[model samples]
Structures are given as structure tokens and as C-alpha cells.
Target: MAFNGKYELESQENFEQLMKALGLSDEVIKKYKDLGNIVEFVQNGNSFQTSYNYGSKVITNEFTIGQESEFVLFTGHRVKAFAKLEGENKLVITMEGMMAAMELSGDKMIETLTNGEITVKKIRKKI
Candidate 1:
């Protein structure tokens, strides 16, 4: 899927909507926004791994394309999600209540997330 890259967060837009959709409190959202976030994506054929860093804490999840897998999210919750490739540069992940689409172009990775009507966009640059 050509989704392999290590990226640093450049900006986040409408992230409050994402937090609300995830059922997180305002305090928790504030704490999360205060941390430095970094992301890494690895693709080994059909196997995919995505890792996130927040200061001293790190969360990693792995899945296979078109296959159902159970993984841990950044909020420390266990959930079942399916990962699938959309064309050459986009990967879509769908869970129980939310969906995420990640597209890469050049040295930038753009992630768009949605839960119901709420949508958030996060942009990252290669590091």
C-alpha cells in the first residue's frame, strides 16, 4: 500500500471533535493535546503496524489488510478494527464506532478520522 513512513505531527484540526467522538472528557483532551505526538507506519506486504509516541508513553498496533484484528488504541482500550488499502496511497481503518483514512503524498501523511458526523484531520511530515 506504500504506507510506510515515520512522521512527526505538524498540525491537527478539529481534534476536539475526534476526542468527543471517542467519549473523552475535556480534561483528558487537554492533557493529550499537551503532549508531543509522533507516528510511525510500517507495511510488510499485507501486515501493517502503526505506532504513536506521546512523550514517555508509546502505543503500537498491528493488523493485516482485509483481515479482522484486535488491537489496542492510544487510549488503552482494546477494540476490533479492520484495515484495508484504498488505492496506492490511502489506507482506511474501520472500527466499531469510528473510521480513519490515511493518505500519503510525497513526504507528508494526511490522516482524516470520522465518528458519525464528526471529522478531524491531522497532518504529519516525514521525519
Candidate 2:
């Protein structure tokens, strides 16, 4: 699978703004703003296990494509989400009021998370 690998955060845009829009406190944002993230994905057919490591915090979610499952967000909020594959290289997850789309391109994984008009984009290089 194209997504089965560990990726290190290369850069991010609007991270603090998006986190604030997501209701994160200034203290919490300051604690994690400069910390890099490592995301690992394990794919097996239609099922996938994804883990996002943010130094002191790690959030993991396991789900099958096109199925509704509970997922823990970076804010430590649990929500029901549905994930689906868009084409061959893009995976999109839809939550209650947010959407996350991750696309694999060569050795890079580009993730975009949108909640209303606020969006955060992170680029990760496979490591």
C-alpha cells in the first residue's frame, strides 16, 4: 500500500490558527506548536491503522474503508468518522464538522484538515 510507511512532518501552514479555531487553548497550542509530528500508516486491503505521533501525544485509529468508526482527533476529541478512498492515492475522512484529506505523492504525504473556513495543511516526507 502506498500509505504504509512512517512520515515525518516537513512543514505546516495555518497550524496555530486552525488549532485555535478547533477550540484549543493558547497554553495547549503553545505546548505543541513547535513540536514535529510523525505519522505512520499500516494498510491491509480495505482496513487501515493510522497513528499520529506528536512528541508527547499519539492518536491512533483503525477502520475499514467506507465504514463509520470512532476516531480520536489531535485535540483528544472522539468523534464518529467515515473514511473513503478517493482515486488510488487519496484517503478522505469525513467527521461531524470537519474533513481531512491525505494524499500520497512519491515520498510525501500531504494532509489537509478543514473545519468550516479554517484549514491546516501539513506536508510530511516519508522516512
Candidate 3:
């Protein structure tokens, strides 16, 4: 089961909590809430790229699994993340205090993220 494909955002849950935990301002948060964010992913084997568009702002990253990879945030903050496979199709990603569990099933990809107190869920479909 190769996950080398592209995916589009379908739905999300607890977005506000995650954004708040990320230290986004009320004005920016409201803007994102009003217009919504668009997320796209391109995966090729253990390496993956994700792009998030919030109207005027965009964040993109490319990283590999089980290795320390550097990435830049939309705000220009540089950080590192280590993504590891839990089993056959589950990817566990750790960055700072944040954790994301990504489950792959055929054409569907579901990701659940948490920052200790805040949680967010995103569902996407291959496109």
C-alpha cells in the first residue's frame, strides 16, 4: 500500500482550539474561521510535503519519516519534526509538544493532532 499520491482537504474538527493553542490572534483566527484553511498533501514514500493556505498566508514543508527534518512556519519560525510509522499505515509525528496521528486507508487519510490540551481532526481524500 503505497501512499504516494495527492490529497485534498475534506473536513476538519476542533480547528479553533488548535489555532488558539498555536498563539494565533483573534483577528487572524476570525479571518481563518470565516474563510477556512485549505490543506493539500503530496506524499512519496517516506517523504511528504504539506501545504496550508489561509487566504493570504501559506505554509509549506517537506520532510522524511524517522529523521529530524527542519521546516518553516507561516510566521517564519524554523522548527524540526520527526515523523515515524507506527505500523503499516499509521504515521506518528512529533514536533515540540504537538503530536499527530495519521491513519491511511486506501483513498482516505485521517489525521488527529493534539498539543496536550488542544485537539484537532482533519479528514482528507485522495485527489
Candidate 4:
């Protein structure tokens, strides 16, 4: 699950496709991309850091994910963000519970969702 290499256009497209497949509208896709590059770090004691990039502006924050209540919590300098997946739905839980459905195309879906740099034409699903 480690992200290797630089971000590429193809990788971005893959990520976009993952979002679309996950039932995210064009608006949501735009906003997620606009949210910029997200870097996640896991540390001691169920604590984690998620750094988000907004163009030239970068915001680094910390929080805990998968430690409480099916939510990914992020606390930043000026704002807090959280996300979650419930059933077929994905949500920005902390921000007024904005939700969308999850769509699974393949492992490329995960690469896209994480904004990974690899361009995978097909991904195998494990049953």
C-alpha cells in the first residue's frame, strides 16, 4: 500500500475513474481533486497524519482513522475533515455527513482512490 514514484496524468485519470465508479458525482470528483494531493502517515498509538495540498498551499494535520466509529478523522490547522464508508456509500462524515455510494471497478479503483501513481489497466478482486 506504499505509494511509489511521482504522480502521473494516467494515474490521476485512474483515480478519477475510481471516484466515478464509486458513485461520486462530477462535482464531488472536482472537489476531491481540488483538495489536492493527500499524504497519509501512521504513527504510534493509533495516531496518524494526513497532509492535504491545495495548490501552492499545503496543510498538514493529524488524527486517528479506523480507531473510532467507522470514520477517518483529520484535524488540520484551520479545519477538520473526516470520511467513511458504509455499505455501498462513502461519506465525508465530519463535514455534515455528505455521502455517496461506493463503486468497485477493480484494484485500479484503489490506486485511483488513493491518488497513487501507478497506471493499472486491470486489478484483480479477491473473493
Predicted model with the maximum lDDT: 2
TM-score of every prediction relative to native = 0.93, 0.93, 0.79, 0.33
Evaluated at residue 27, the lDDT of candidate 1 is 91
Q: Residues 1-127, candidate 2, lDDT per residue (tens digit)?
A: 3689999999999989988987889998998876658889999988999998778778889999999999987777799999999998999999989999999999999999999999999999999
Question: Ten consecutive residues with minimal summed lDDT in candidate 1?
Answer: 31-40
Per-residue CA lDDT of model 3 for 62-96, tens digit only, reads 88887898877655678788888877788887887
The candidate scoring highest on TM-score is 2
Summarize candidate 1's per-residue lDDT along 1-127 as a digit string, tens digits.
Answer: 4778788889888887788777899997887884546888889998988888877888889899999999787678899999988888989999988898989888898999889888888888988
Give residue 52's error in model 1 in angstroms.
Answer: 0.4
TM-score of 4: 0.33
Clashes of each: 0, 0, 0, 2
Off by over 4 Å in 4: 1-13, 38-42, 55-66, 69-127
Ordering by lDDT: 2, 1, 3, 4
Give Cα distance to truth, residue 27, candidate 3, Å. Answer: 1.8
Provide the lDDT at 41 for model 1: 86
How far residue 87's Cα lies from its native spot in candidate 3, in Å, is 1.9
- Flag clash pairs in model 1: none
Worst 10 residues of 3 by lDDT: 32-41
